[model samples]
Target: MARATVQDVAKTAGVSVGTVSRVLNGSAAVSASSKEKVTGAIRQLNYRPLASARDLRRDRTMRILALAKNLDSPIISEAFRGVGDAAALSGYVSLIAPTAGDLEREQQLVDILRNGSVDGLVMFSPTMPDDDIEALATQLSVVQVCEIADSEAAFGVSIDDRQAAFDITRHLIETGSRRLAMIGHRAARSGRLREEGFREATAKAALLPEQTLFADGDFDFHAGRRLTRELLKMDPLPDAVFCGSDTVAAGCVREITGAGFRVPEDIAVAGFDDSIQAEMCVPELTTIRQPAYEMGRLAFEALFERMTEPGASRRGRTFLPHELVVRDSTKGEAKA
Candidate 1:
């Protein structure tokens, strides 16, 4: 059978070819009734638009690049899945670029992305300075996920990491944990926010001073293990440890068990990002359930919106909710 074309769709829908084209391209200018008719005709005819022709008409590559600090991280993987799924639904190809938390590398990626390499970009945990991101926003439609850009011109989607950390720390304290320790990447913005939250909660509970032990490292399993070992040597070991990521938490759990300490009994461990590793842990991990997938999806949607409507107002910052998931790792609440 001959492939159905836009002309046939327009004829069947009793609309101009332009109207059909608008509908096919997801143009907001098309009316709802006309869109419904065009969609019905497309369904009846099984019409499939040619990508080359559409790209020619739109003057775009229909490609989006997502830059992640660490593509191997489970949270980042979930977010990437969301971005890829959303892009596929919209008939756009999605690509991933690992920045590995290198500012120079991210800047280089941005330079490449700005040379008409892709239609737009999505950044996860970008390490670039706010000024650089703000300047980049002027050149390309960019959306950040899991990290907030300081400029209002740059769009972002993230959970309130500071508040979530505070809540989890409060939970640990309420359950009788006085000496608290934190292990995570301290230089990163997300890590700083989490640490701030932990400090705020501990300070409020009068558990500050020498009671709080802090160790900074890259948010990884090895870092967690190494830091935990150092923490264990403290004059009075912390009874509770709050980790920056689930992977780190898993390492802490392993180290604690190897040291003959029981989770939530002798040393409570709480982690951020409720990734798959959280559930696979021996006693299950108490963690902050960051909506990684949703953040990714929303970030892409924000960028697509800008791409579709150039004159639209900038979407400043979108903050999603974070939940505390209590498991056997902590002695506090059973589940949240």
Candidate 2:
């Protein structure tokens, strides 16, 4: 029931505790014969080195630090889950810092947590600048999530935002909506990328660039309501509204209804990231499925890679595919 100590390993391996310590710490001074015996004893006894052991062996502590925009956001929470699950599997534990989507707090927390608190960081949806992130990486491992950042700066795992938005916008155009409007948040990388995709697609169609209305807003339900209200007030309301993310679309839908406009009849509305709330909406939001669980799973995996193999040149852009889910909010689809 007790933790296997260095003394226990020494007794089992028939070597001195000092020799066992040397092998655990990867000291070359320990003879090969002694190292083999200690390692074999460790395997047979299933002995795990203590936190103190890492300090003795590597002159450091074993800990993982995870940062997210906020744990309350469903999207960010799932990302933390991925980091935690990966840490557990890798024989490490994670401490989370919920940044509440504040840039200053994100930077301050990064400075605070990147010290001895944790060996490395798994930052989700950070608003910290590129130079700040690049500077942090020199001191410790850093893996970022959700935001489409400088791929050369850090390891990132996220959904294909541009493509996701492009497809959804195209879908709206095909569904009898020529005059389209987009509601999005301009503060973060994902929102910006989706907005870029929307603008690019509309321009390619050459259907009156003015017809594609674009409004900047947060990715929340209120932003959606505000943007939708603005669009409705325009001289000519958009036939369909394409939301950057689902939360915004749902909000827009509420305002649309309040304004006496029928969804999919007078003004169809679509959203992104088919979060659970999407279905809870009155007409079951038509949205993009952003693979929340998978995104979380991979973000941690990327963080693990950064931790175990620092300076791995992990400029990897891992993009998970997204899906278009149509419901009553869009066109009274046969599927939902």
Candidate 3:
């Protein structure tokens, strides 16, 4: 007897071949009743979806690539968790790569992954230029999270970093912090947006140009510690400091307390990306809660949607919500 084909299964199921194809491909558009019938027919006919046959027909690898600047960061870990979970549910596997903000390494990895190894790509806080990102998107489905591309050619999922920064900075100001300082990475677009927010808020509060201090670093603990030491040296040191990341804020907290100053009493502190460090710090950090997990999950979903339906309208940008989390680090009476 000849092996049953998809047509045979469709005939047995009393549905069109397209309907059976959609069901076999895990498309959610198929109704539960139709799916039941198709599955039953497939079982009855003893039909099997051979890997080579499916790949030849669909031209898909059932794999995705996820790129990040650094996997050491808690934010990246959380986001990757979401990506992994979502990919598993969709019968796909995720491959993670760390570019470490090196453009050459990014190019090399992209070249390698673009060679039919992945069906799509998801990037977290990509530091590459918009033109480079746009060029990559033209070749394959790409979704960026956190730091988004400036062009409309690529899809993105992120929170309103500028607005979140503004809100957090305003919160510190309202809490009576006059002299404000900021520590962040100058290399990342997200960091720049955050700095912009801080500057905008301080300017609105009429802070002196001299009083609004600024420091740039790699958005890590060492940078936080080094910059905090510098900020402490200024004449009439800043009464409050905002860091671009929770890890940096934790470093600042350690330095400040080690210098014999009480947090929120001598110099208040605030951080972004309400990561685990925010809660684990000595006084706990007041920070912005970005939806990192959801951003990652949605990035994959958007990419997968484009992969399944190449002609479908693309969701160019998706902005998740952010919240300002008040904690002991930035809550207290104004110090005289």
Candidate 4:
């Protein structure tokens, strides 16, 4: 079967290629008769909108802006890539705005986005206030991922951090680790959730309530290394260390191995976000799988739907499920 082409559409609509292009682009200045003819031809020929044509449209900018913190993180990079793939299929263009943890810079980006510069917006782990989000939603399609804590706020896609974290903690406990300590981050919801989950799991096992002997630094290797050094210095160092993120765990592993400590023998390490680095380590990190790419795809799909059809509500929020990934990091069981 032969596929349809722009010339075919133009010929069928009884208009020039330029006129058909203008109509496809949704140029506001296009005459009603000409627009109708082009639109009808589009339907008849099963023609698709050209993303580039968005530039020609006046009524709609057809541009989407995505703002995110932690651009350097591999997890963030892949998640946004998933969103971009989904957006491309629908003929949408996205402008990525990375804030890199600068609160003021993030706010500046939001302020700029609110001026009708883009048709849709996605904020990944934004530090913006609820009032600002509500105000922005009044004019544009808005969605959140990973950082949304309030249900009343804009639509979001998240995972059960508490539950997943608990499961992993318990798994380590069941493997016989008794003196457990956690290294967690304080800036993100996932970090908090993972902490709560680990605590709950430890509690369920009726083991000594684990204290955060070491806290993971704010999602960076330097922080992880610093905390690891501090934790190792503690009298009666923990046998098992749970990290809030895989990056932190990687740092912990490096320090532990270099210090002549054996993984899963003397000390076990578990982390969250099963990224590529999970397997790259000498002893792969046993972590939780949050399906970052999947979450990103679903988020953009939801955002696109909202933009094209107003008043269409999604079923009581969607939370993608999580999984426990067991690896050599926590390879052995401890005495109860």
Candidate 5:
């Protein structure tokens, strides 16, 4: 049997070669009907384009790279799955590389990307400065997911962290939690936004500054355990504790339980990112559900758009909605 070709696709779709090209290149100019016809013909013929050849002709790599602090994070892993799935539909390959939270290493990777190793780059919870990201955007198609930078030149996709935190914290306040404390890392932008939300909710309740306490550290179980232990030692311990992530909350819960305190009876607990750890806790955690998969899909689409249409400006961020899930970890008047 003979192998299929672009010309064959055009012929089978009853479209011109240019129309097939436009569809393959993801051009917005291509009509929906035409795209459907071309895609159908492609499936019918089992046609697979020679990515390398096509890339060479167009000066593209037919690839996109995702950079992250680490691949072990459940949220980042989910987002990477979305990117990979979307890339498959678009005939592009997706690769995820860890930056290990090293700014110099991240810059080195970006420099390699600028040399045309990949068609575009997607950053997950990036640690790089906004100015550096903006500078990179001038040369490469860059999209930030999860923890977005404040750069007008770069495209981003994430849930509203501040608003999600505010909603969750407000839930605690409404449930008779007067003394609130938050445990979060001050390093990441998302953490800071979440902290701001916590503060905002505390202030709205007219709680004294001393009544609202905070402990800044990394987003890890150990940080939660250590900081929570310290918070418990304080006089008039917090009635409610809000952790940055489910992993942290797990540690907090364990520490509280170990100290002979009952959740929501002695102290209520809340967490973010409704991860698997949320459910594994003795008392399931009340947390905010971030749309990580959807964020990843949107991030890839944004990067693809920039790759195909360089002239279009896809500045700023696309925000996804978050859900507040109430569970046994927090003592609320009502469940949601």
Candidate 6:
């Protein structure tokens, strides 16, 4: 008779291979019911665990799983590339998986991590809540990239979004833009921070509350166009608009130019994430250059550190630098 393998036991137990491994390794993360089921399967299959095989099962996979909402954005791809590069230096390969804005799918990925498929995980703009992520971090190696939840217990890497937004907003003010408005989404933590920074800059400039308009929508081109149309309908249009992202800013530019308004001269536009779309604009875009690649690299390093030293204290989050790039969209003329 052939020896029963882990897969055979998993099939008989009606559980995942990881779950069976967890049962064999005595991981407490496994559910009571599932543990019982795995044990029953082990006995039924008459599976005898070999000491050497168990040790091999306990070894690291040296693989990292990167979870993102999507990989289409240049900024996101750049960040993932950074992760891959950094992981490569440590003799580990990185793989990306899109969450597609599905919470259930996100949880499944977490389960896969628990199953020991990957040595660690790095999340980009995760949809999971802070508490859930924090809990996961306690049991598994995890790190967050941009758009992280606010939690000291959870390690992450991101630029100072509020400061970046403030710098851009102040630049617009310095370049003689007063009647300001911001088009941002409230779904992400970064958006809210940028909005707060925008508000701060406007209030400090002594712009009246009514002078500082606001619109909430998705961080995309269509949302920018739709929101800009509504903003333009106001009695007095804003002279300057700060979009949440370069994609959104492109939409804003298209709509404003389509309405016979010249950028900067008629309606100055600014955006976050100095993505390729920023340069693709006719007059170019003024935006914040988030250190996405560096953040990605640092995110993996952080996760790797934890994976190698599971008992080490949490290093918390790291804030990378952001640069303000002045372009024709916001700077109509050279400012002294």
Please give the TM-score that candidate 6 achieves against the real structure: 0.80
Model 6 error, position 224 (Å): 1.2
Ranking by lDDT: 5, 1, 6, 3, 2, 4
lDDT per residue as tens, model 6, 232-274: 9987899999999999999999999999999988899998898
Which parts of model 1 have CA positions greater than 4 angstroms off? 1-57
Residue-level lDDT of model 2, residues 5-40, one tens digit each, is 556789999998668766876779998899889999
Inter-residue clash pairs, candidate 6: none
Candidate 3, pairs of clashing residues: none
Write candidate 1's Cα lDDT for 1-336 as tens digits: 966656688899999877886787778999999999999999999987544335543777788988988777888889888887667656678999998888898888887677887888888888888888888887679988887878777888889889999999999999899999999787778899999999999999997589988899977899999999998898788999999999999999999999998998999999989999999999999999988888887777678767776676356898899998999999966783
TM-scores of all models? 0.83, 0.78, 0.82, 0.79, 0.83, 0.80
Clashes per model (N, Cα, C within 3 A): 0, 1, 0, 3, 0, 0
Candidate number that wins on lDDT, 2 or 5: 5
Candidate 4 RMSD to the correct structure: 8.7
Cα RMSD, each candidate:
8.1, 9.9, 9.3, 8.7, 8.0, 14.7
10 residues in a row with least lDDT, candidate 2? 50-59
At residue 57, candidate 4 shows an lDDT of 54
Whichever of 2 and 3 has more lDDT, that candidate is 3
Global CA lDDT of candidate 6, please? 0.84
lDDT score of residue 66 within candidate 6? 88
lDDT (10s digit) by residue, model 3, range 1-336: 855656688899999877887787778999999999999998999986533324433667788888888988888788888787666645678899999888888877777657877888888867678998888786678888888878576889888888999999999999898889999887888898998999999999898898798899977999999999998888898899999999999999999999999998899999999999998998989999988888887777678666775665365687899988888999653221
- lDDT for 225 in candidate 1 is 94
- Candidate 1 local Cα displacement, residue 102, angstroms: 2.9
State the TM-score for model 1: 0.83
lDDT, candidates in the order shown: 0.85, 0.76, 0.84, 0.75, 0.87, 0.84
